[model samples]
Target chain A: MPASAPWSAAVGQGGGVLRSVDIGALELEAGGELPTVTLAFECWGVLNAAGTNAVLIQHALTGSTHVSRGDSEEDGWWEGLVGPGEVIDTDKYFVVAANMLGGCYGTTGPSSIAADGAPYGSRFPLVTIRDSVVAEARLADRLGITSWHAVIGGSMGGARALEWAVTFPERVRRCAVVASCAASTAEQIAFSQAQVLAIRQDPHFAGGDYYDGAAPTSGLGLARRIAHITYRSETEMEQRFGRAAQDGENPLHLGRLRPVVGGSFAGRYQVESYLDHQARKLVSRFDANSYIVITEALMSHDVTRGRGTLTQALTRTEGVQFLVAAVSSDRLYFPSQSQELAAALPGDVKVHNIDSAIGHDGFLTEVGTVGDLLRESFFAQ
Target chain B: MPASAPWSAAVGQGGGVLRSVDIGALELEAGGELPTVTLAFECWGVLNAAGTNAVLIQHALTGSTHVSRGDSEEDGWWEGLVGPGEVIDTDKYFVVAANMLGGCYGTTGPSSIAADGAPYGSRFPLVTIRDSVVAEARLADRLGITSWHAVIGGSMGGARALEWAVTFPERVRRCAVVASCAASTAEQIAFSQAQVLAIRQDPHFAGGDYYDGAAPTSGLGLARRIAHITYRSETEMEQRFGRAAQDGENPLHLGRLRPVVGGSFAGRYQVESYLDHQARKLVSRFDANSYIVITEALMSHDVTRGRGTLTQALTRTEGVQFLVAAVSSDRLYFPSQSQELAAALPGDVKVHNIDSAIGHDGFLTEVGTVGDLLRESFFAQ
Candidate 1:
């Protein structure tokens, strides 16, 4: 580990291009090896002469590496924060974002080909957040980045960002863990298990190797529906949908069977219809096997795993500038969790509050507040 | 609606025994009609000379008429609350508990036979909580009871108790609605929808008509698992099983395929294992079709459905003694909702708090607290 690496060989290979590279094998923490690991990433700006201006940004579960559109026509998820003049300022910093190890994007996951040249599917080894961080580290090494100016992320991405600081303290100058905790709580694990079971119970799942035939769309849809409800606040759902019936249809009449226009009473509440839309959208864009793999990895997230304690695990990143925040009304990851994470950190860290009525999804929706916090805490210097 | 029917034909026919009788047809509030409605009820103690000492106890979802061990040897779910010397005091007053209309417990529900001699199955009409209360009223009429001394219920049962006070204020002297809200909140509806969809998504569901073949036990199990999480507190889950793996099995290694004693790597976290046990127990004893029907009916619960406002709906129960209480840690029905229901009542009705860490299930688990409250309020009289 060096203080900085300048004039490295892999500096300008991907200046601002969305590209995929073989990061090779990943030795998992749970005693297993992924024969081949491919990471899909996007890079922006150029590595400075000192290489200290490089920044790493991680995506949350189901999120891709497209942090901002440099060459792609589609807009990124965090478009507000990673543009040229935005808080992340890709024009001034060499910014990089990678899809997690078990992601469905271009990353090597359950959908990817195994050593036998067939889809790994159910045979894909269990991956943890630490394993994904390790894979990303190898990618970081190739890109000639010795130390990052800031590693920014929220939710699961925040977990990864925090791991980067702990696992490689000298390599991460600043860490911003927003809307996440140091470890997955029991409630979080409980919800995740339900989602996993939802997929497993589907007949079409075929042990997660349904690629040769009909995909387990129904199971994946149900998983998404469950997750979507947790993502948004209950107050927001009530205020938005209320007791209103779906457009021109009444859920009141949705019995087991009745003589209706569709020959079945499939009408739903407005809120149910909204969840259906989300499920349908995810089914079209994501892989069911990958969703399960990534979700399990997230469930295995424990910053203190194999470490002495929460304080001990976090103690590795002693003097790193920390910016932790939480969504005020988030039931999934409460503000109290962020407060706990902040208190455990060995620094004068205060958990910033993102005041939004949208629950856990507030971190993504209320980007202006997140952007402001980032600019003040890490970017200002 | 007579003042009394002491010599009614249905009286003393069952005589403190678990019995079923046809209550005839029911016209639903939403629409349509049930051709014939059968109610299964259990009575304990005597009706008294004046028939004024009768107590009506409504059971929650999945609950049967067996509130205590009287005619049956099996112990009841609320054995502590409804025993001979308990707060409810079955020895001093007549106590009656009925299975909900759409329930599987000997009641005419989705599992009942239709005119075609086949199971109602998918053809079962939509039922509301009000519809259930209406059917129970007919049963009360047959039992030679003009008015109930007090109506006691919790959870969905609480909704029924509140409905009794509103629909027939003259018939209910005291109403104890514990751990339930006046209306189903958006969050409640959202969670309920997920559970319903879980069952419906099962390939074996066969559009809710799988009685002739394999039942949708997997789907029903998943639904129960989801609902079970909402029933208990996050703190309780953490304290009981905080990322602890199941006995002799590590959830971290629970991949798609691995040679183990369990035959697969589906080993779960301790919390997940607990949920699996709950799901399995419900599947063995309950009907999936009935589960869906009752759940939908619960989602349709709103005391002020057609009524103008909360004040208007509750105004019907003027002069009724209302005892409103909530589980302090309840996530499903917040204490604030109980406060709202109490505020809408005509008199000064304050929401009593059941101080327990059990969450929404507190009303069922903390029997001593509820017993004390009942003795202090309605039962003592």
Candidate 2:
């Protein structure tokens, strides 16, 4: 490995080299076990003598387990905040972050080989958020740990944590649900559907079987562009970008970041660059099939299934202590939804705040506050 | 025209048979001009003695000028709420409801012709909400009206009213802005872009010139489905359509009201049908070029342009009486944005409310309360 490489054993963060570890053919949901399945995970920090301080970090829509640091400068995603004595304090907790069931990364998603050795692609069956949690449950059991000190996440990860508390009530002692809602809002599902369709419609997508041909990068880029806007707040965009123009760059050409009038055929905005970066990064590590797979999973997240409704979902999680927080600027999962989630979970779960200029992405970008909340929530575990 | 058609001139919606009014090339920030423009308009009541009572009824996105006539078996969009003794009280006001510029209606849009008489399609220039108001100003001038008693609308139309006050302050005496915001949120634009791309990706789209072929109707249907969720609230959907299956249709089929598992190979949700209706209606009356045109226009509605910063945008509108309202259930344009808008445009500018189960779309669906607020905003003109 190169000297600048991050820890390859665990994650693709901080310039870390990674190797795929399959958790083959995981069973999930009421219907039956999927004929074939896989789980992808990356880890940081050390497990203590008691082996009791484990934290399972969940991800949001279009996210992976690369929460910072890889083998190179381009390796780490959230490395600025999740390592050493950083906000997440990897030095203290054995952080176990894994890509969900329907995710890309090294997981068995749409890009994974089917029984026929061909990509599952669109042929992959739809997955629910609960199924993702169920797969994670199998991973937890395999890790030889009866219980986790805490299980937490933001956005869809938050949805998984809620499930952890309800479906497997005893598996997680302390739960932190961040910037998420109790149920997928129709508006949210609608938006997710649009993103999925955007990717699916790319000519290069080839109906999700583009393994041999070109990938639907443009469609994926457009999808990421659309989603990136929601991840940020207006104030932050105003302060960070706000119609600012890139100096000396042709507005009509690539890498242009300003609103140049009468410049050329296609003017570029800095915002567009930002979105393109996000989309490119995602497509590089994430599979298009997994993108659709996970999105569909997220849209199906609901705690009220076997349980009657939200109240029942909450009531079912009797003894689980939880920490509920939301980004101040989050638009996708409004802070109110977090508040509602807190109200719905068992026993007046303590609500925390991560005040950030970024919207839903605060959980990833503005990691300091989230780290601090995690610290407080850890003790509650 | 059919007796059920609400759009007929016989219904007194517009002055003459919906005339084909040519529009200018709309300049866009995203690097393209919506080259061709057409506008559909209808005027009801009379242009009284002094022509001072014109209330320009701005329709929401996906809405048209047939606000009160039942042109089909379907009810008029704003039926029972804008006629003779209705809240808008056509008995007293001369209402001029015109399809905004860049719209898909009889107005000039993507489906409209270029100088060569071919559909403008992908060659359409970008049009802004402010641009729409500018185009409306031309119509106002054509009718020799110096000022309007009131300019009213909800959502997109509400945006127009605010622009009218800023651009033609002397011509707009009273403005009623309801369930709207000062600017489009990043979330708002993200959602809109997703819809645009969804339609663009359909293989049948054939670039922007799909007028003669399959027309990418499926993609448009999906886009409409996405937009509909944004327009309404989760609470309303839950109350009205949640988990409740249609009479005989399975959840997977297009006819079902609620989504069902294993119902169709296409994964068509009942909500998908609703979207198809919206997209189909638009396809029939609107052009794909118009969708891009108006959407681009909406995305660029930064009232602060040339006024310095955001504060300046409000400062410039010192004499305007603004009514900033938002649906309690609205998630796309949070009520918080409305608060910001109200604070920015103060004095006689007040913040109103439309408590509904619907989300952002509460602006249109919850008529009674919204109508009351409208009357209060303009003091019955």
Candidate 3:
């Protein structure tokens, strides 16, 4: 029995081995060797000796390669999908989930050690989704994998998958890009800029070098709050929280709202409280510098960069088919983006929509539906 | 030649006299009387020996009673319309423009000294558009005016004019509500909430009591930036500025953007400079606290408050004639608001559309067109 606590989040699979492996030396695209890098991962099921049935799982923003059981948490992320004889079928396939580059987890990220022996932090070079894919490809190469049974990711992970298909097409035979888009919208970029500003403007930030001291938790929390609002629908927010006050205190300082008379409380709105919680959660685990780096990467996820047109950029990939899915209620990565991606691919690739009121987060919550789709896609093989 | 400079903006005629008055020991609506108050006003012509020919002009958001003329500056903000013998015809009728109740300039506002001798700031009680109209009515009563020739204003100012027609229907003979809606839209309120948050969240702001030190300039600047963006169209912004960068040092960085790729200090985005100028101009003349108050006031301009349905709200007035108008380009005070107001208005209240590319600001621009519309509406007199 695993000692890990149960977290019924869709991705959590009950039991899995949490481990880290040093992938030896990896050569970066910039011709630098990153030595002694351990790719932290969580594995579900037996390797079946030959390891030919390996499945690579990608995680989203603020996610980890610890896709299943934690040290003391039995209800693992992706647990439902990866249990014995489940959709991911732990009994049949070995699932390896690895953290992406520039992530704050055990992966080589802004908090990772640089050659100079200091945290990469702000000095971490800007990373593109392609760069993350390249790093992951190196990990794949180290695992003695010339080809994979399948690769999957949602959100930023999905962007990485798209990049993987293009950068190392022959390796990823099948890919699932969920609740994501081929290109970040200008609106997305604008919001990302706001988050960047929020973090940099925090007096405690100290130019991203305050690692030994206070991190920019306030700004990071605010950034997370801002992003969290966008991740859900306005209608949902209104219905769920509306104008209800958090505390009895009126922000307006007019005492209680008094209904038709007056409104009060500074942090009165329930939504504000919701945001407060979300922000706090982010501030706890996310690093300020890593937040900036990862957000910029997300914003710069345009495959069409320097490739002229999207079609041209997409054409660079020659391997596996893809399962393109977008959350129906997602305003950020609207279903239209999925249609565009599907349009760009060869051979009438099917476009799927997950009807969700949860907005962009539907992919994280509607695991059953997503799992079913994954099962169908994999079963077809 | 008048060395003191006429309040009038016209070269050949007077926009009006820019004047001030002291209303001491006057009772207020909510309670006790203020010890002393000074009101700045502008007049198109003489109040007339009989004072019966006076026409009151209400200004809108970011507008003052200074509808025309400046002692030093030749280009008064409203120079395009109000003039000696312009459409309002200062030669025939006396026109009076009063700075609003909660304004920043010379009039009382959040920055005004309170009974305790400190800036009202956040302590200023929440006042609505109706409150504004009531305050103006008091000004009229103090001026010994039984009735005005017409009450005219656009946008929020227009909302005030509508309140005059409904709250004191008999007090207003002719009312022109331009570039405004009957009620604020959910979308409009949402955007305003965002802007308010932007200002309040500024680190420099000490809970609306920044008078002792630096103001929330960054937050206010961001608020103005948002408003400015909404005040213009995407097409216009694209045509006027596009993604061009401003000229600066060899490698200037503006939130991740610099001048052309040539690496020379060539220039910056034309739009960026425009936004910068807009922000700076506002920062120079406006107080953040007053901005908070007025923005909140505008946000609270709901015609459906206390009153019955919108139609019933209009019916509350015993007698009045109304003219409703909205700018074609206005996204905030959408043209549909004008239509709704006009539809609910009993009798044949005329509705006019002022065509301009400047959006809601068009009510302050396209002077020739608005002047013409004003003339037609008030011509019945």
Candidate 4:
């Protein structure tokens, strides 16, 4: 059995009761060995006698393990779907949401001290999505979860859930991959590359070992700005900010201001301010090193790396049921990709659509819709 | 009359016979005064005795006045459309393409030296798309041309063409706006803000005055990468680089490499390399400060600003013939925006669609289709 401990999130109070365990060393898919491996998770309710009532929920990129507020004061990211009498109903099923490996939320990651007593920093080995899933399986074993009643996730989390169904088919009885695909598309990798470069290009990054110095907050902020644009839809941005200037500033009237020594770049548009706010929020809480590591892991998300073709890899889950869904307006992971994933699965699986103008983030924002679908489909089984 | 001179392009020999004239200082739209303004232009063929056979072709952002090769040995950006026997037949009409006022190609911009013998840098006053059109009008006055046979452009160039039809409707007999909108949308502004921030955040940028030092190449590169992604379709990216590692390097296998001082961020995917190559090419031939100036001008693109609603703004062009077109797969400038522009126009305007899988770039890549449409519509008229 693994030893358990308590920890809080980088920002808000971590929802529910947080627990963690050192899952021992991990052999990474990219060749290096992670000397130490720890998984931080949050659970609600109790496991049934048979332990088949356990449901594993994976969090998206930059997300925490908090699914719904339990004993903690913080409101969960998915507050509408995982509580008592809710879709994933913690009242009956044991809900487990673990912060993926390489995550910073109470998890052992790049920010964690290595065996050499120094932060992994630039020395942290690249961890793939498959490697993260393998580490999570060890955590599942330690938790006495021989098999899960359901595995559910969206976005990066959905990639994890799909990996769970393929890597350890017997462990996941049912899977719901929402607003995600079986593999990271080239476009996804391109975006990820830019985000990673944004963080790394910061002067203060100091080769990723800036623990004792100023963190690469600017780079982190820029990365978040790039990412926040992708998360929301163009329609939403148009309706929200339009070409309107911020309350007191005018993007068109910047010339009247006195030029400062460093070139005063004032007069931000409302949308620019919105992006700045997002960047500032992320920089305050998230670790830059952890961000790069996690982003790289996400970029390495391919279910059929060494598992032959996509169909052959998915054949392992022939008996497992799936509830695949895609956000209608998701530009990041298009609905067509979801259709492809669904067609590759056993039987005639249809991709459920979450109709929203919220883009790729609909899986998190349209909680009621997600809850309804889960309640009627995967959870119903 | 303006004085004509000779100047070679920073890239290849500028297409056609390049010429320039000092248009003098002018008042800016954003409440400022430019002390000096010069417009660089290239002319092909000859103006008819009446001077009514002159056609103005505007170039997109990062594009030069060189539309089609004539006296110069270099290939032109629109060689397919404005050749001797092409749609806009250089043999039959005087084809004129001008570098925008804030462009780097022999045009007055942030890179231009002020009266103080120092580059404008960040101290350069903001120039709008309208201001550029005003400067171009001065150029027209000096060239003894009263009206254009037709004004045509795509993307930023398209934005310029729309401005010409509205700002000086009497001067443009026919106009073609391709893959562009009358105003900069919130989404466009948001993307522009990110690109601006990317440059400003660069440590080497030095408040936009990095001419004497190492320029913010990385920042400019990041901005280009971001912009290039939006320029093409997701399908194209998938078809082109799909998860395949770059030649001799695997993005997923970076961990086995030695943990060098700067984290040896060496292993790049093929897509990343492609972006890097694009960045390098631009850095070699383009000025970073000029890029910011032109980008800001494009972001400030709004034909309706201070001119009433979109329909009211377009009223000036009631009698002018229009050939509006949109790239079918363009995400940056959606077909809906083209539809909006077409519907708001005075006549029964139909937005010609340039069908291609290349997205917004189809306006540039689908030359045959664009040519056919121009020949069938406004040019034919």
Q: What TM-score goes with each of the models?
A: 0.95, 0.80, 0.74, 0.95
Instruction: Report lDDT (Cα) of residue A162, candidate 2.
Output: 83
Q: Whose lDDT is higher: candidate 3's or candidate 4's? A: 4
Q: Write candidate 1's Cα lDDT for B1-381 as tens digits.
A: 243544322444223457777899999877889999999988877676577788888888778888777756787777777767778886677888889988898889999999899998888989988899999999888777778999999999999999989999999999999999888877787788888878887888988788899989889999998999999998999999988888977777735333334223455788878888998899999999889888888888889988989999999899689899999999888898899899999989999999999799998888889889989999875
Residue-pair clashes per prediction, in order, are 0, 47, 41, 0
Candidate 4 chain A has its poorest 10 consecutive residues by lDDT at: A2-11
Give the top-scoring candidate (DockQ).
1
User: What would the per-residue lDDT of candidate 3 be over residues B31-54, giving only the tens digit for each residue?
Assistant: 344455667676666454444666
Query: Chain B of model 4: TM-score?
Result: 0.93
lDDT (10s digit) by residue, model 1, range A132-200 = 999998888777777899998999999999998899889999999999999888899889988887887
Candidate 3 TM-score, C-alpha based: 0.74
Give model 3's clash tally. 41
True contacts kept of 3: 0.00
lDDT of 3: 0.67
Please say which candidate is ahead in DockQ: 2 or 4: 4
DockQ of each: 0.59, 0.23, 0.16, 0.57
CA shift of B162, model 4, Å: 0.4
Model 4 interface CAPRI class: medium
Q: Write the per-residue lDDT of candidate 4 for residues B149-199, one digit (tens) a residue.
A: 899999999999999999899999999999999888888988887777778
DockQ, model 1, C-alpha based = 0.59
